[model samples]
Target: MSRFGDPEWGRRRGGRLTPPEGLGVLTALIGKQLRARLGSPAAPPARPDLDLALPDSRLVQDALDHCAAECAPDIVAHSIRCYAWGVLLADLRDIRFDREALATAALLHDIELGRTERRDRFACLCFACAGAEGARIFLEARAASPDRVTRVCDAIARHLNPDVPLKPYAESHLLNAAAALDVVGAGARALDPADRARVLATWPRGDFRRTMQAAMRREQAAAPNTRAGLLMQLGFGGLIARAPFGDTL
Candidate 1:
């Protein structure tokens, strides 16, 4: 089995955080905010490499169609915006990555999250791992290449990390950064203001905060032992509520 398929192995570190890392997340986000305000390039610009639109490919379109059909409008918008931010961050950071893989990972990282009403879907595993498995089955049914499938699923599995390393996991790193920025304002400053505006204007934030907060709370209630559940226990909702964009959205 691929290492990613091993839930125990994945939980060992990627999703499970060291206490220091867990504690450092809020501090790091505040630091990023302060640096951006004080005229420091704390991270790369989330400026798009292309116009803000879906990549012209059958696979991406299929993923979007599936996501939209299954997810809430807010969740669908969040996933699309994640794709926009992921590509933009990748280009600005000079990271060599597969665009399609990044987009697929971004759009489906929260696949298992759609039907949170059925909490049993992820009662025993991290939502990220469950999402990754769901994404894999969906992609394989569409005959996505093995390497692409592996990378996309691996990225979904890892996006819950406080920080994903860019070396061997560029796509994962970008997806995590974008997802975090949308949810907790992790790299809010790195994204160019104008570009960020464009993405949000196109996708619309809707009731994302409430939707995602509910999802997180449900996950925490169902799997308190998982990293996400543990983090939610550590006041993760407050962090999401306090994101810089929260005021406007």
Candidate 2:
């Protein structure tokens, strides 16, 4: 018997321990080694030219955190890119808008897609409607004024409805145009090449096209009669064929 009080303890078998390491210990050791090798995830790249001087309110930070937790990394990155693009476009066009409201709408526009309750609600309504409701509830809880909450919800709800004119509301138009630019390269031609390159560099696409395709497929599977499903069934093929980055899908 070994001095450790077990026969297997300290026993060598071909220069290896008789008893293997515990599963928990081995897993922890592996995790530590991997972290040491890779270091922490790098901070998201900055786009100084597109900065909008966003508000420093805790409510905005909470909304951003909620978005990050509810959405996939690529989607979260896309939201950030949307905000930046919206701000840049507004600047280019000399359009005045509520920067913080647009940012809030952009970040939370897809929050419903990542939530179980919201997905359930989608059985009867579109994701945009669910997202608007979710954003409203979230903002209302954070003590946002009724008017601000309404504007944010309106921007989110109308983002996917191209037929609902976005004019008269800078936030709505900016969010719609920005999302369009990211999704299918629509409206991208209006942006300066250098601006486009900067945004892409700051938020590297990193399989976004494929991720979006998979998301659309899932939506189609879950709600075949819904707007998203109908659009995918009817227009996705054409979109894929015409999109500048369609080959990526």
Candidate 3:
């Protein structure tokens, strides 16, 4: 029935996969709307408040796909995937979250790469800036209420900087978890067991990569008959879906 495309059209004829009771449905609706606005050429380069009036999941998915298609390092792609998963996990865990804020921030958390001129720092800056840009978009979209938007924007901006310790923000844990997913899900060239072990050794308390891997392992254990766990299945699937026609792996 959607004009853009039917995300769940194949699920079952005329059967809408019902949104979980309350806030879960609300978050999904808002996410869908934001996704649509992101794809609109006329949409300003700012994040929009969850208008609540216009919640459309297909739109949000499109915007995310557009962002993911802008082409960068595999690490960046992995981060976006993790960011998406983190938002989903936070929701599934019933964490009190600003889903729109988190989704926008996660999608653009590494957008700065588009502005970076340095080859070495390009990826790092891109990753951070994209998130910052997502936050910026969210903040700018709701210029009417600068206070709240700025707070979320600030969190997205500093999430990855080891120099910028996540001390005061309430969303630090979510952001850290997102960062870890990005690192762990990065291409084989970027991370392997050895590299992951070293980082996990350094940060023993709460390592995102370690956590994602552990979570992934548990999921796989639960569904041993499946080809791959859901997170990997989705992350790798996203990567493949975004790859160019002639691209390999």
Model 1 agreement with the true structure over 142-194: per-residue lDDT tens digits:
99999898789778887876667775667878888899888987766776787
Model 3 ranges off by over 4 Å: 1-80, 88-94, 118-138, 141-144, 162-169, 185-249
Regions of model 1 farther than 4 Å from truth: 1-49, 114-124, 246-249
> Between prediction 2 and prediction 3, which has the larger TM-score?
2
Residues 1-249 of candidate 3: C-alpha lDDT, one tens digit per residue: 321101122112121123232234345435644754555232122212212111244434543564566534443444444444444334434456555555555555544332323323311222243344454554565452564464455555545332223334435446645554445332222223443333323323223333334433543444322212323433533443342212212
CA shift of 208, model 2, Å:
1.0
| Best candidate (score: TM-score) | 1
lDDT of each: 0.74, 0.64, 0.39
lDDT of 2 by residue, 1-249 (tens): 321111122112111212232233334435634754665343233346556544677877887899888889888878888888888878767788887889899999877652434465432345666677778778989889887786787777656543223455678778877886687776566666667777777777666776677777776676555445555755663553455643222
How well does candidate 2 score on lDDT at residue 244? 62
**Which of 1 and 3 is the better model by TM-score?**
1
Quick one: ranking by TM-score, best first? 1, 2, 3
Q: Which pairs of residues clash in candidate 2, taking residues 3 or more apart in a chain or in different chains? A: none
